[model samples]
Target: MALSRQNQSFRIPCQQCPLREITHLRDFTADELEFVSRFKKGELVVEAGSTILVEGAHSAHLFTMLSGWAFRYKTLEDGRRQILNYLMPGDLVGLQGSIMGEMQHSVEALSPVILCVFERERLLTLYNLHPSLAFDITWIAAQEERILDEHLLSIGRRNALERAAYLIAFIFERGRRLELFDERRFIPLTQQHIADTLGLSIVHTNKTLKKLSSKGLLRWQERGCEILDPEGLLEVAGWTGLGEGKRPFV
Candidate 1:
């Protein structure tokens, strides 16, 4: 028997999952993998521009991003929406909602996305039966925290140029780590998205991006921006890059 969502069948085996093959990811033990296999409820395929989670809503399922890009955002009372962060493969969603009472932010898919679903009520089983999995959960949360901190720093303190550089470099490096970065790959983000993330006006964002493009640091494609000189972006951002690490993808 199989469960379904959104006119698609949900099926992915943990044993032969492709994410396990990512070089930076730690290999899961057989038992841990087995547990995770059973822990998964199904998969959900979300179309671009679809809202996957809503702010202040009760979430019934948690998700691990199998593929594609999404962003977490919060809308103020006056209707200004601030993009909190962009989410990518192997990132967890609804983690806070699974623990807390209601979701504090909304997630909107930027591209067609595949997400592995888990029963939110059973999340405690992973924590109680598998200490290592619980630790991985903690690690993921801390990683997200660091990203949020950096984003806040960029928006609150960094100048427009530095902010733009940091954002492009940051997205490039994360995509590069996932082996998904290339000239041919569409970034699935628009200038509007960048403006929202940086808290800049659309015109200001375009001007800043043009400066990077003129300097040969990046190029704007039809629907995406290309990282031509990642090193140059890094230099402008004053960022060293994400340090060496082993990440757990399950």
Candidate 2:
């Protein structure tokens, strides 16, 4: 359960952001930081299983993930869902909402999340005035597109075992980018999450995961899965992952 929820008007200096201290994230200039600091609205504590951004809704704010996990997904008319991508701590959410005036995909918190909110209207100001910050925004969106491309390839072409392996390795690498890597850390995901993500039935997902486990690639427990050999998973998947970049976190 969520411990508590707080909503307010607050300012967080960009230079002082927690994510900035951890990853090879881009550092903001004084002017840029000031602009972003003023842009910040407040922090939101979102509970796990709560929807953060709803599809087709007009959202006035964009959020930067301060902590915890979320996933972007879309559901069809018959309620068939496709998990698009996992959102890590440093990931930005609601870019589509900010740009298009309505959300195309929904975001749900997988773990209790802390988000840094910023007004959507000021985005054009940053783009028009701060060239570097504008590039960073473009980079962030490009990265998200790249992830979706990978998912499309996996779901469309990869076999069941390879698809499962690819998803684990891909999410783990992303977690590493967020500086959330720890050998002993358990990925807070259930088999059903994997099933939905890979477009597999729950039983098929379990069988695929067991195959990965028996091969010493991962250990899947009741509550979470632990990555044992990422390289092994990469080999199994026959898919190489994305290269790291200096990304912006705000």
Candidate 3:
């Protein structure tokens, strides 16, 4: 759970942020950009498997993912975990903690990650002075709710194979939009991760994955999952798509 905070000198200026170039995110106005530059505290580098935010704790800072991947999850008293959602570059972290005063779920890094830190206390300034940015934050929250709604439907109603296909397809589409997949088209996830997310046993998850692989929908690798035919997966899951349009992030 230990995080490595970089020296303030290492902070990436908001104007030079690589995420701003992403076509899926809205462009920031000059004033907004300047305010964000001043608002950023520094950078934090966390290794894979590190817990970035612990449930029930009040965090002093918020973060924006600059690189790598992470997931939000909650565990029961007996340690059964349910993954809520996955996060990628430009995704905001700890907003709930900032607004609600405590984190309801924990966040863990799936790979080495870089996060832009922002002081929680300064959030009011942004809301008061920049209504547009505040709306963007609201949009981001609504977007998370929308994704959760889809996951709830999958877990509550979809069959085992359908749920697996839906989850994989969901991740693939989001990553594709962010240009995260490389030539390998690999998704950095283990069977256990999939099982937890889908509310299935590890054995059942493995079998379901095998079924998908046999149908040329995806392949399971030692390191992760490889997407072969996203379109076929969508058809199997009976999902339309993530819906059209660029998404906003803070």
Candidate 4:
């Protein structure tokens, strides 16, 4: 069946669905969901290779992914682009501007995406009215901060192989937590995006990617970057899944 759009709340009946499983909405009550039920949403699932929201567009709506992946990126004046983060299902993208008023980065669909959008006005009201909702938003912001810290470390500290390995392991663990891991396949992130995320040139990124593939640690085939031996690379990167300074999620 198609997703329900009757009210601000949307219901996808397939509870065991991978994306649904990752969603953190279980803690929210039905009454607490009223504000979202009235939201104006996109009719079609935004396809991969499309812009979800442009940078500095007076972003008056906050988004929650009902399904699929997206990424946040920004371009510098010299035309150097950097992917700030890869956002999966259940991740909140626009909450950073709840107080600031506009997004600093552009958000684009990384895969076919279904989004639940709540207007800025309504979200502000809901945040003020429901402490739980506000707390959830706060937690999402903290998670973004954690990711930024790691991305900085990947660029500053790790070599190309280690940088790539850290990113692979990071996404792998996240996918595992949501039970979204596909042992036969890895996430379909683009080489260019990975290069930007790791702050490496595409040429260098390709060489490092080929090295990893040749080592049987991963396979960056036409389909996507598949992990052949996650353990091997994990040991090389020394990723503990803990934060740089403190325990993760502290």
Q: Which of the numbered candidates is closest to the native, going by highest TM-score?
A: 3
- Write model 1 residue lDDT over 130-239, tens digit each, in one string: 99999999999999999999989888888999999999888888888887765654466899999989999999999999999999887797668777788999999988
Minimal lDDT window, size 10, model 2: 1-10
Per-residue lDDT tens digits for candidate 2, residues 1-250, read: 1343657755455667887677567778889888888888888889989889889999788899988998999999999888888998878899998988899999999988988888898898888988888888888898788878888999999999999999998888778777786768578899989999999999999999999999999989876799988889999999777576777766
Q: Candidates' lDDT values, in order?
A: 0.86, 0.85, 0.92, 0.69
lDDT of 2 at 1: 17
51: Cα error in model 2, Å: 0.8
Q: Which stretches of candidate 3 lie over 4 Å from their true place?
A: none
Q: List the lowest-lDDT window of 10 residues for candidate 4.
A: 241-250
**Model 4 agreement with the true structure over 1-250: per-residue lDDT tens digits:** 1222323334443323244334423433555545444544432357777887666767766767766777889998898988888877667767666567776788888777777665777776666777776776777688779888987888799988999988888877666565566658578787887888888888999998888888788878663678788787787687876423211110
Q: What TM-score fits each model?
A: 0.95, 0.93, 0.98, 0.83
Per-residue lDDT, model 3, residue 31, is 90
For model 1, the local distance difference test gives: 0.86
How far is each candidate from the true structure, as Cα RMSD in Å?
A: 2.8, 2.1, 1.0, 5.0
lDDT of 1 at 125: 89
Give the clashing residue pairs of candidate 1, or none.
none
Model 3, 1-250: lDDT tens per residue? 5765565787678889998898877879889888988899999999888999999999999999999999999999999999999999989999999999999999999999999999999999999999998999999999899899999999999999999999999999999888898877899999999999999999999999999999998889985899999999999999988876877766
After superposition, the stretches of candidate 1 with alpha carbons farther than 4 Å from their true spots are 1-9, 183-185
